[model samples]
Target: MSAPMPPPTTLEHARWERFKSKLGGWSLTTYGILAFAFLYLPIVILVIFSFNDSRSVSKWSGFTWAWYGKMFQDGQIMLSIWNSLFLAIVSTIIATVLGTLAALGLERYRFRGKTAVDSMFYLPVIIPDIAMAIMLLIFFNMSGIGFTPWKVNFFGARLAVPYSVIIGHVAFNTSFVAIVVRARLAQMDRTLEEAASDLYANAWQTFRRVTLPMLMPGIIGGALLAFTLSLDDFVITFFTSGAGFNTLPVRVFGMIKKGVTPKINAVSTLMLVVSLSLVVVSILISMRSGSEDSVTIGM
Candidate 1:
């Protein structure tokens, strides 16, 4: 039989516990720093190399704006950028309106099959982008909706705009906007709307005067989110882009297949800046609106 273990001395026990606690904290901090570096270091490198005078990304080269100039001069790249911007703007507008309406309907009224409807709206958020892209591709092919591209004349250049791609963007973006707007609606004070009704205000008047203004931040947030998603989207855009059309991401993918260059890095850096700016703006709007809500509730 084994002998019973002796109790640890109080002073020794305290030192051991302290050592373990410090070690664990240090390990976590180290891991966090390493994880962040691993994720973002490549982006930092890419941005830095975009300004490289030499084409090699791995070696340090004198700083220059040559890549940026090249990016601007490349007509195909410029066209892709235009397409991306156009898609983002149109999709954001369509998504915001439809999503806001959906949010209002879902939040304000009780309806049969509400849970299923809610799930359907959220499905896009949870679904994998590749799967959605493939599904969209198949649907567009079967429906023959996006086969013909609309030719738009832009400063003597005619570009084929794929309507199906726009439709797919709206389809996915609507769900995201609805989710954001629904969250804001959930936090809103129903009493304000009630007060409006008690004043004999019509539905349109009440919405315009009371709810719409209050919901503006959320609406803007959702629109920005939709715009960012549409701007950065690759998989869906690639699949639904049809023939003879390319968004920036698809263009970048094609460039990568051929070769990598500082010009590609420059384009990526610009996209990153745009995406981060949109996110920052959205966050600021949400925070401001949250603070306002808190103040209103306090009153």
Candidate 2:
């Protein structure tokens, strides 16, 4: 038999492989650095300015904690912070429950116009925030409901505006939570449910004991996403919020527009720290969960 001919590695193939490897390596490093800078540069500046004694945003005076102390003393800021927290918590709860149920339904059941339904749920996410805000404004205006501008009842009782803002936040957030939970559901193993059913477990029992546990990570993740989005929301809240209803973001925007101050920087820095810490904690929890899952599988 003749000597086996070596398989040909064409010049084109070699060039393509070299290009891919080089491009992948360079792109990862370049993009990683860019992403870090994009996210953290503003945060770094904010933190630096927070310690500055000067009220001017650009000029740095001696370091001082006066602005932070002032922030604590400002009752409006404190009230806005509390309001934002309450809105986020309530909106996240509502969004998570509805979104998780929607995900489960979409993943486990077949129905008419399934693709259309998915697209509808995702439409809110893709719609421009300004447009959505405008639409919500129009809808609320046309609803024939009495728009009470503001009235201070006993104990400073407020009405309507804050709740409307929460409704808008929840409406947008539900779509996001649905998408995240749906993605998680798509990747889950149907065999587990099938096995549970084979073992004579009813549908509810299987879902409660087996499906729910597996879906918890995605549900929690979606809830966190909803909470963050609600906290960070500005446009919808601004449009829907009537007098006496100011969210943290809207308040900060107004403050910045009037004049930049170290107090604003301090608040921004605090928000950045909280957001980053939440992200890190979420990632750590996810990794720990994944590791535990792998160990269980191995066992």
Candidate 3:
């Protein structure tokens, strides 16, 4: 009979491999938990304090809805909220349109200085906020334009800093939206558009029917991103905003400078919820679109 073969190397390796893999997985899990805790702990405390009856953020006197009531009852807070919402909505629409066009032009067309153009679009995102703020302030000052609100007598109506904030938001938000839309466009298959064109479809028709549908996820995602950024922007808005114009973020900053209040916490909690909801919805929509595409391809 042949001598018993030495235990297979594979079997010997498997024994140690299982133990190492488990250890590695445990380490990764621990790290994830620690990271999540670090990021969310402050948010948790803020939310908890929003319901606290006490004026102090450090100590909770009792649970109450007084802060929430105060948040709404405070005329300044309500006005700031309205301003922020208006700015976000207007900026999101403008950014989505401009960024979508920019993405389409960049992705579908080739031209001189294309890379440079792309870099310029990304500059806002990469530059420091303070630098952007100062540059905008100086630009406004140099132009000899009053940073004050403009009154438009359209049909016997008046408008003010609402438009100014919206303009500022759109300027910064467009770059971010462009980056997001461009990323999505890059991942898309160019063949789809080619096929549509080969089927006797005009450029506009092909884009509207085939490309736009495919790009919807990106468009919506980018719009939501722009909205959130506009809502949360402080530094840029601070420099660009006219007198009597206050976005929610600027209002919050002002209040915090004075002192932290439960009303502020309530407002913060509400904003956190809104931001989180938008992000979650966008992610879900993207995931669903991806899943549908996968199924279509598989079939």
Number of the candidate with higher lDDT, 1 or 2? 1
- Top-TM-score candidate index: 1
lDDT of 1 by residue, 1-299 (tens): 46435437988777777887899999999999999999999999999999998989888879999999999999999998888888788889999999999999898899999999989998988899999998989998889585567677755556677888888899999998898788788988989999999999999999999999998887887888789889989999998887778999999999999998999999999999997787677667767776444221101
Which pairs, if any, clash in model 2?
Answer: none
> Best by lDDT, which number?
1
What do the candidate models score in CA lDDT, each in turn? 0.86, 0.79, 0.80
lDDT of 1 at 267: 94
lDDT by residue (179-231, candidate 3, tens digit) is: 77777788888898999999999989998999999888778778888888888
Candidates in descending TM-score order: 1, 3, 2
Winner on lDDT (2 vs 3): 3
> What shift in Å separates residue 176 of candidate 3 from its native position after superposition?
1.2
Per-candidate TM-scores read 0.89, 0.82, 0.86
lDDT for each residue of candidate 2 in 115-217, tens digit (9 for 90 to 100):
9988888889999999999888877777754233333232353422455676788899888888777777887888998999999999899999999998887
- Residue 118, candidate 2: Cα error in Å is 1.4
